[model samples]
Target: LIGARLSGGGGMVSVAAGVERVGVLLEGFEGVEIAAVNGPRSVVVAGEQQALDGLVGVCEGEGVRVRRIPVDYASHTVQVEEIEEELRSALAGITPRAGRVPFYSTVTGAPVDTATLDAGYWYRNLRHTVRFEEATRALAAAGHRVFVEVSSHPVLVPGVEETVEACGVGSSVVTGTLRRHEDGPGRFVEALARLHVRGVGVDWAALLGRGSGWPVDLPTYAFQRRRFWLESGRGAGDPSVLGLAGVDHPLLGARADIPATSGVLFTSRWSLWSQPWLADHSAAGVTLVPGTAFVDLVVRAGDEVGCGLLSELVIEAPLVIPEQGGVQVRVSLSETDDSGQRTVQVHSRAEDAGPGADWSRHVSGRLAPEAAHADFELTQWPPAGAVLVEEAAERAYQDMAETGYGYGPAFRGLSRAWTRGDEVFAELALPEEAGKPDGFGVHPALIDACFHAGVFRSSDAERQLVMPFAWNDVRLFAIGATALRVHLTYQGTDTVALRLADATGAPVASVGSVVARPVGTEQLRSSSDVSGGRMFRVVWDRLSVRSVEVGSGFVRVGSV
Candidate 1:
């Protein structure tokens, strides 16, 4: 059939949209016929190869997406008549039988008795138009809402969804059995999961029934959204020069030696004007501080005391920085204990807050002696055994933005990424326009970019919005680096060990472990207004003119 069609120059082309308009355009062409209506707008036309090519050109000229079907033969057109005798002779032995189950025939655009599917019927189907859209509509009209295409790939799911939607039939779910190139056990399991999420009951034994394979356990802790901009505070000048004692940290301005108590308080104030890069981090349409900034504060506070390790910092809330006004942060440290560990807590409130305003405690942790570290290196540049994640790694930032993690130029430092067994590595740089890295012990944006690399883990699981909830054994070894190379190895559950280095592979910082938890939009909305503001206006669309006769006793009002 392909040889014959190739000799005769017959082919097909598909248009993605403008169904009605494209149908009108096709009417003026020669030898072309509407081969299939897969969906409301997924239309396929087939005829002489020259006419099909012309149609594709016209569609492209009008800005409609068109794809040429890879085939030398055109079906469902007058060209089939040339092969009619050959098909009849070849299918002469076909014996159609009645089936016990119902069958919706695209040939008839409705359910048909299978007893009528004889060789002649098959021949007619081959030579006639394919009414896929109409057949799908028939299924929807018959109260069928859930559609699972039992095919090797999901070429028809989108068309099924669009067809069912145009029927105005409440709602429907369209899924597929497998996808091309993703025919593995995990993809099949994901297909099952899609059904499960839509209230469908699936057999659990299907996956576990074969082997001793088990699912990887994920973290279940609830956490807040991430949108923090942490600035590594730089010592401005001598604090003792003024009457009061102060800390030279960029984020901290004054230090108060509490009288009669063994505690000390370090204070700093931040505003958009002062730390403009903070505007880059936003979640649920509100600007908030990056969670890494808390780690930065703890690291600085550890330097202030003799402690060099941030033992563990757990976030309790997200610090939302309002568009106007500044927020003041207080990092309070307790006296060293028997273990030489001092409790540290971070709290914040607006600068103009009233006397009775309650301070929001964002994070709390303990500073302790540095822990022994594992020796690691990223000097191999692209890494020895890692492979580019391809499209997933390239689309990292775009995917994050879609899930409410909007990043501006400051935090968009991830250049390239690669993955190896149980580990992900990223190339990061703090954009120069973000600001000078002069004062920071470890610039917050650059460090935060390390966490962004974690998104690549979803290549094996579901894509989710995750935030760093706990920092353990964090220590900064260098300062004022504009670029970094980071390595994150999966520890357990949702935790990873972070190793940071400079462009030349020199060590800058390390985290014994960083634990992450998923963030929900509901939790974000609780603290900020993320409600949708909707407005409506009437639109006039072309309406068909029609008339109906009035019954003897019934009165008809409106004019057509």
Candidate 2:
């Protein structure tokens, strides 16, 4: 088609935003129109070159990411009308019928009648907006979980993943057939392996020319999970030389004993360079260490004191990371009380603070040598009679973005979720690109994702910037979990009892009760030097005469 026909002098660009926003951006440019709504956060517009260039500048100035699609012809726009008649004439002799396996139409975003697939229909398909997002969503809603893009390259896998995530489908796997330059045998085998690892049912008999194999359980710990928390410090000297114990942790540097009260103090430092993953846990345009990290600190401190049980931990304030420089973390332990419990307090301060700067307390908790009996199990999958929170699942990510809790790749672990009487359940996993280390009893991002499904648990009236306020009788049964099945049972107002397990229903962690409360944004700013920026200000410039007058022939004949 390119060699024999006209390549319309137009262009296309994809914007990382909603279709509504893209529509508003093109309101003044009639030559431009939305070609496709690929996903909730992805839209493609095609139109004249001049209009696309202007749109790119406007999007970039507003901090909205947009990219041109590197094409000359405007697709799925009014420009397609120019070749509509020719396309119809060329395809007039062709006939489309129902496939042996049913066919779904992206033009309609659903299954269509085969009789309607005539030359006119083909022409309309070329000129109308593509409904890729809607079609993928319909397939997901119909209980189809496994998707294979049998194309020359993996053009739509990312879009499929985004659409599936938006639908909150329970456990969907998408794989590609081939690649651009690597469409060899090795690539094909790797593609099969990808599907195999994700537990997709495959007809191996067809390929092997032998009997099929039955599925079997993977051995315990057959899968490897990356260690994500408590890494070694950078550019720090050995604390042993200064009568302090060297603490090996990603966020902590050393520890010292408080001889005055027979207590212990744990010290650490943080910077964007030292812990770049912290940048992923952003909320309300501020990068703060997740609340789960604070809980992990409590657990680590518990192990050191022979009190391995976290009785309770409450977040007093958020630990915001400044755009520049670093912050110091201090976790101090009080002397053991009669019940063998020690008071725990966590505080942080900017490294380059003035002499008068004070360590702001972020969390307070207690550690006990023993914990009372508490068990949370998910023996029966999905809990009988649980209904899928379709609305909540579909809007989870979009709603989160609107509320300022933007989840980057690291924190985007939630896949699908459901709810039953007073209970919410979800499926989560560590993304391949999350780059989290192993060795943690429970990775913060994995645990923090447990609360994602709770978006449906609250009414709009109760929604706000909230953090984990209190945790009671928390326990960890397993360590270094990468995939988790979470269950949260609401106790009362803003409280729940959390239960976690591996993919195979093996217990990982449990909490007797959890309490959450909203915090003030001002308090968060006070805790860190990070501040928000004013992207734009009201500029009411004085209305002046136009530099170029509208009309020609400016001779003042009437006045003269």
Candidate 3:
């Protein structure tokens, strides 16, 4: 009845033939009016509720099943139909005028001609189907930035969102009735102002003063360039020039230029070495020879300040050989003192005159200072052909879990092992208090924590976080006293295959596929929330580690 009052009741039609005949009978009455010319759709009769119920009963007694809707009255009867002729005569006496802005027709889903706003257009509007969706899409495509639903309830906003996504339209549509504050209209204005600021960086006042138009052109801004120094030659005392290379400079003005000197400092070579080997294989035997060379450089510069500039340089020359049956090589280094004294040092080793000897070999000493280095010597390589699986996994796990919050109890007793050319696997037992009522439960958050620990221990140190982009084939079977095992196989940078199992190695949950990416500390920090208060309080009088085992394993348990 409310909808009929607003639309003039011309769009209602009874689908049932019996109801249509009843509508015809009601139209014959004097009080009612046929306000619309609705076509072969469900007819809406608007009148007093009691009278409508009585009419329904009368129709039902005549073998017509009449269904009464939650409406007030009967509409679109003959009484109202008679007014059409009178309205036509009244409109024919007046001259129509044109409008500036174009108005669209919801009935036809297209623009309507203002000059042809005649009686037929109004009559057709009552019979034709309402193509609201198409009309809304047209408005959106025509660059309408905002849409307001002025109805009593919000029913069109959802349809608009779906339509916009489907049609690939970029305009923002909003429903005003859903605002939370009592002063919703004010809030809407503020939201529009904020949107303008975000889109064009113009304040609301400035936008309003400029008639809400955006600027077309703006001046370009530039930053100051930084300067650096590059050596023209291979010595510290050699002349250097200032330029923008080899150093990262800030966007600030350059510093004051320093005074230059006319005299140039040069370095002298100190040592050099060269070795050559020759061999011949015949019926008699083989012959071989070897030699060596070295060099060093020294630099000297007069002290304009206090101390004279001096530099000692050394070079390890590589070996050179002929393309014949024998080979030759060279090695050398030169050093210069403060007084420009140069020295050279070289050494060579070769074997070329024996049954198992070859002339194309050269040996040299270590080029770097000797320091203690840790190396893992594996008995055999992994069966999967993955090198350093255990070490790499350890590093990855440590890096992933270095959040300083300490790992969860689910990560207790974690261990990893790799079989050469076969597979790399790791297992960890959950602490007893992990999933208890007073302890952390097997919720999504706790699962994420455990995942971080596993990933951190098995990824690169630079990888701060591994985003679990997806989950597949995941299942949770039992809880309490059961450990969780995570098995992972990396395919590439963005894809990984994962399998999750319980303490007994039974497949609890398996994800045949997942995507992951190595994230940096900035991303991790921004993604995580920091809480201030204590997460959990342990009422313990004292706490200490009883003992620590170095080689066998490390275990620490405490009590409150």
Q: List CA RMSD, all candidates.
A: 22.9, 20.4, 30.5
Per-prediction backbone clash count: 8, 10, 74
TM for every model, in the order presented, reads 0.51, 0.55, 0.26
The 10-residue segment with the lowest total lDDT in model 2:
551-560
Question: Per-residue lDDT of 367-402 in model 3, one digit per residue for the tens?
Answer: 211121212222221123332234443554345345
Q: Rate the local accuracy (lDDT) of all candidates.
A: 0.77, 0.78, 0.36
User: Tens-digit lDDT track for model 2 on 1-560?
Assistant: 42245375788898878888888888788689889988877889998999889988777666465767877888888888877778888899988776666567889999888877999888778788988899999899889999999888987887888899889977888989887766477677777888988888666656544322323567877687896554423345678877889764555567898986758999888877677777888777778999888887678777777887898898877888876667778999999998888999999886655556677888998999984343656655555556556545347767777776868767778877778878998878887645564645677878888998888777777778788889898888887889888899998868888899887677888988888887676766666663223233222243444333324422222221
Candidate number with the higher TM-score (1 or 2)? 2
Better candidate by lDDT, 1 or 3: 1
Tens-digit lDDT track for model 1 on 140-209?
A: 9999888888888888897998888789988678888887765567667877887888888777767454
Candidate 3 wrongly placed segments (more than 4 Å):
1-96, 140-154, 170-181, 194-560
After superposition, candidate 2 runs with Cα above 4 Å error: 1-234, 260-262, 354-356, 371-374, 391-394, 530-560
**Highest TM-score: which candidate?**
2
TM-score of 2: 0.55
Please list all clashing residue pairs in model 1, or write none if there are none: 227-288, 227-289, 228-289, 228-290, 229-290, 233-250, 234-250, 235-248
